[model samples]
Target: MTNLSAFLAQNAIKPDSQERVVSKRFVDPETKEPMKWQIVAVDSDRDEALRKQNTKRLPVPGKKNVFQPTTDYDAYLATLAVECTVFPNLHDVDLQNSYKVMGAEALLKKMLLPGEYAEYLKVVQNANGFDVGMDEAVEEAKN
Candidate 1:
């Protein structure tokens, strides 16, 4: 038995934001140190919206006017990374222009190399609490 008041909006605990050195190439001019990127946990509502935006409707075979919704996982991750990134301002037009990219997702893709991008995606997932699995959690609990 738990008090329902604890579930109230005001009583909710907000997710913590984290900063990680995503790239060593982007260094501070004065300190000559790697720059850190700020990432935050995306709420479920926003996550759902991003997912929907990346999903496409494909025509189903043998059925006229029938469509099946398919989610583009790579596109969704790129969008999620863009949304969760608080620093470097991926949405900035100037940044996009400098990278010769149009959208935030494109800007992110252009900013990092392939390997860096993949690692950054892992960091983003960790920040969003997606790095944990139920099996691991169960194992840890039993220990």
Candidate 2:
């Protein structure tokens, strides 16, 4: 096979995105009830606006006051961009006013709860065709 053909064959896109259901029932922090969520890996849109969003970044407020991603959660709620908003802090907020002009793709990096963050990372890595096995590797190293 020619080198050109080999290169073309190497980058085939998967027909379906990766998705995983929560294995164990989780307690909804607020409702105190069992909850199950299906986490799905999605594609990032390469639109001009989105590109601009990524290019633009929020400044770190430093030691005194750190920024909160949940503050911008409302915006993602409208676009349902939770999958894309992986880097922000996801603190529980009853305020409907949160999630606004958070500076470009603020949703790109929300601070999620530890478990939620791990799940989000899994989706992102899978979308990028990365095996999310660093944790497993670390565990194996300990043995």
lDDT of each: 0.86, 0.41
- Candidate 1: tens digits of C-alpha lDDT, residues 1-143: 87999999999998888999999999999999999999998989998898889878899899999988877777878888999999989999999999898999999999999999988988887788786553563344233
What's the true lDDT of residue 63 in model 1?
100
Best by lDDT: 1
Q: Give Cα distance to truth, residue 20, candidate 2, Å.
A: 0.3
In the range 21-129, model 2's lDDT, one tens digit per residue, is: 3323446689876554343344445322333333323445674455432222223322333443332323324221254425333433332354764565555455545
lDDT of 2 at 41: 40
Summed over model 2, clashes come to 13
Residue pairs in candidate 1 whose N, alpha carbon or C atoms collide under 3 angstroms:
none
Which stretches of candidate 1 lie above 4 Å from their native place? Answer: 132-143
Off by over 4 Å in 2: 1-15, 26-51, 57-113, 130-143
